[model samples]
Target: MLENLKKEFLQPLEEFTPIPFWFWNDYLTEEELDRQMLAFKEKGVDGFVIHPRLGLPEEIGYLTDTYFHYVRYAVKRASQLHMKVVLYDEAMYPSGSCHGQVVRENPAFASRGLRMSARESAEEGELLIAAVKREGKTWYFWEGPSGGTIRGVHYGEDDGEAGAPASADLMNPEAVALFLQLTHERYYQELKEYFGNTIIGIFTDEPNILGRCSKEGMIAWSGNFLEDFYRQGGNEQDLYLLFADTDSSEGRRAGERYKRAVYERMSRAYYRQIADWCAAHGVAMTGHPEKSTDIGYLQHFTIPCQDIVWRYVAPEEEKAITGEHSTMGKCSSDSARHRGKRRNGNECFGCCGAPEDPYRFTMEDMKWYLDWLFVRGVNMIFPHAFYYSLRDRRKEERPPEVGMHSSFWEDYHIASDYIKRMCGLLTDSVNQAKAAVLCRSEKLSWEIAKPLFENQIEFNYLEEELLPSCRIENGCVLIRQQRYPVVITDGKDTPETRDFLRRLEESGGTVLVWNAALTAQKIREAVKPAETFLPPARDLRCTCLRKEGTEFLFLVNEGENSVTTNLRLEDGHICQIWDAWNGTIKQLELPVQEMKLSLGQRESLILVTDRGE
Candidate 1:
């Protein structure tokens, strides 16, 4: 399994091959495009994502005139050199998605961005459950106006008169039908034949739909959501009906539940819509977040439903926050007063406040992002972008208008090398989701206190004292309603743990306490006589070092004393030592038959064990 995993990890990665650089808005000159690819090819990049400049004289149609020529030429050229190619699908940003910007730029574009206006009257909300006929097909529209403040996003020179207070009026069935239809025509329909497998799937870049702000909310969706919600025993006959008033405690709970359910339905609609379309077309789809807060959703429902790994702003944010003397942007606090707070640097930095240092793609950033995303269930990435050339540009190529206006071209090689190395470890790690804590449907801490589940982040590891009785899975200490015998490594066993362990053992569960805390009486007290969460009546003991199912258990010396001790999980259970992280197993060379897995102050060792090895 390990070997197969390694092979799987390297195979897809060996083929991933991102196209090096691009010259986005540098519209004219096919000659220039060729020149860039040729230069990138010389630098050893095996693939790329190229697109035409928007609104160029030639970009009037789907792509610039020689678009296909460029694509076929690049593909043919790359193919000759054994490389892969990807076309930055037509258009860019909020409107480029579905030719939404094709119509005159909405005066509302700069005004509301994607906010909604006004709470829907109950009459309007309830109508969301009604089936409306559009083009002879009855479909569901949005149930109500969404609530949000559209005062933020900028669109060139602000002619902001606040526009009309608007919302994502999916409640208007006509709009819902058109959205679904447009999805089919724009991305699906014949995308399979158009790009075939060469284009692994549709990259649904930024799919923000709110046109204005609403105190109620303004998300867009099709008819399937409301009906499905009702079918699942929800009474949202009209979306406009305020299921819960968030103004008061009780109302807030109800509103939260309503919003959560609706968001789930809406999010799933998107996942399924793209997923189903992708499966049908023989490809997989990928998407990024509208904001950084959506990473949890991506872990549980969003990315899992899609085949590819997702990207988040954490990497950049973490970098900016910890980089040298730099501090996080003032707006990072999520405070109410942080509005209108730009970093005042004309470097044209985006969300993370400053651009990534192009010539120096930091390894520290790569390691943090890789480990973080891995634990979050993302096994793949397209990264921010790969430009065609680091060429100078001033005009818009198309919708996104995303130019390679950075040091990316110079840092190209290092970034690609880092990406390739990381992919090699990640691709095969997809199947490593074998063991996980089943978040209880009741208390629901897992829903909100999600960081605990993804506690592998370097600074976020468990504090053996606070959450000692935690179950080891995917580098996290799993906590639940009852006490567990599983050597919870993070904190001292809580008060309820003793009884839980006793019951678990009574039920044939084996409770193994971590050797790291054997010195503490509370640690032993936490593991009751009877086991609860593990096998019953099974022998359990502490091992200075042991192995259990693909994980290594090393009881580190929390105190600064070097002590040699006998090691064993159970009598005569002769443990084996292997280092899978580097593929150097069976290196346990010790005369006492007890090899020391050393740890200094705040040090740790992973004693991995796999069954049937």
Candidate 2:
């Protein structure tokens, strides 16, 4: 049953329902809120990842006593109607602890603001400011109203400011740690008291490990690793001084590790910490990582750990997210939009799922990835976003609308259905594995890796061409559920590579490491690739197995075009076993060692080599 279901897993819920976000805030009056909620509610959304939007300026800042009132009111309304409401802190995307106008939006100070673009801000001029001085410190803010006159931004704050542009500073461990504490406890005191009466949980946006979040021009730049980094590493201070990513060897190594460590640490600090706190006070936490790449970094970092992972772009040297070390028994891989392609929208940009239009990679692309991730255990479908419409034009604003351009009613219908389909597959995916992907420590595996791990579905990365045939394990990587010979993979000869190769060598299983990583010397030097394989026919698909009373052939059709399928078995060349691919059954009269069928692109088909008949 699990095997059969795994085949069609992602197919069901592979559409965009609602991205991990929403709209409706202080700007929208109580009446407006009612109308928006009612409109969306009728549209059949799973829930809303609510926030006090940047557009709702007067609504947030420090989560004071009064802030809770509006929140409570909103929560009550949302809850009364049984809406899934996720509270995204006081501010909008920047989170509440950022450095924008809340402090000083002056062009000079703007550079100091977190995430603020120098060119954009200067053009727009100074923004409304409202800084708070707590214990001899000037904390800034500009939670005024609206996305407020800015298209693209550049030069975020990392200069004379608190590790910022217009976003929160996460490097200052204390600030980060404290911010987590307050959101669940201090900030939402009244709400926490009211609990189930209002507000479900909080949505913490890309809260990466930051430096200084104080809105003031002065802040200690030392980060979690600054001291030690400065000690063993030369010019540690210079590392922190970079306004943008510099490719210097010093900068690269330092910055990479900084980004990696920050991602991991913050996940633990915020996801786990804040999640636990929210749970205690009756709130749930969910959002993508600030460092959208680094999958494993995120997996081990956050508290509750966002069941949903996001895929975005960075330098070519980065994969968004890479697992901590490497753990391989077996796992899955997923894909998102084309990484390193283009950047248009916000969090929901192209990073959302594929373009809902022509559907970029195609059905085969979907099957290709599904099968891979099914092995890894990632079952949740938090697509990049749902555009507010179906008639989506190119390069629009924040709300990407899941690639739609139709009105709410029409778009909602399509989105809700899409969400349901994806949710259904992912729901079942949370617990099983259909097959496995091989990880080669050949170390040079990225050639094969890029095709498989370059993009993501949830937090896990899997090539789209591969998703249709796989099942998500628990929310990460791809899985075949049933192993297949010629397991295609990027070639890297790490310990991971050795094991898969060893399984086939020492005992008899099969894994195809692409590019073979071994040069003539390496292949000849190793003399037989240092592993074992179950001996059988050395043609067509590689491995055939008979364990206990079960017998099967792990077939592989690596050809780009269609190839004939074949299976030689004990029972008078069993006409047909069971076609796992499309769940069809076939019977051939004569002794045909090969079954003729057109193989889909990048397709892997495993035929039952034997049967009881």
CA-only RMSD, every prediction:
13.0, 12.7
Cα lDDT for residue 289, candidate 1: 31
Residue 73: error of model 2 in Å? 2.6
Worst 10 residues of 1 by lDDT: 336-345
Total backbone collisions, model 2: 148
> Model 2 over residues 21-132: C-alpha lDDT tens digits?
5533223346755666666666655455554432233434326455565556656776676665556663434443433432232222121222222222222333423333
For residue 530, give model 2's deviation from the true position in Å. 26
Tens-place lDDT digits, model 1, residues 1-613: 4454334323334353433324343343557666756666654466565433322332433332354555556555655665654443324332122333221223222111111224323443333344434335443433433332221111221113342222222223334334445544454433335454455444444334443333333344333454544654445323323321347654544444554554565455444455555566665443433433332223212222111112223333333123211111111111101111111100111222114322333333333333333323233334433344334332212111122333344554554444454334323221221112211111111221222122211111122222334544432334431223333322234456555545545665445443443432343243331111122111111112111223333222322233333342321222344322233335234322233333333222334333233
Candidates' lDDT values, in order? 0.34, 0.36
* TM-score top scorer: 1
Q: Determine which window of 10 residues in candidate 2 has minimal summed lDDT.
A: 336-345
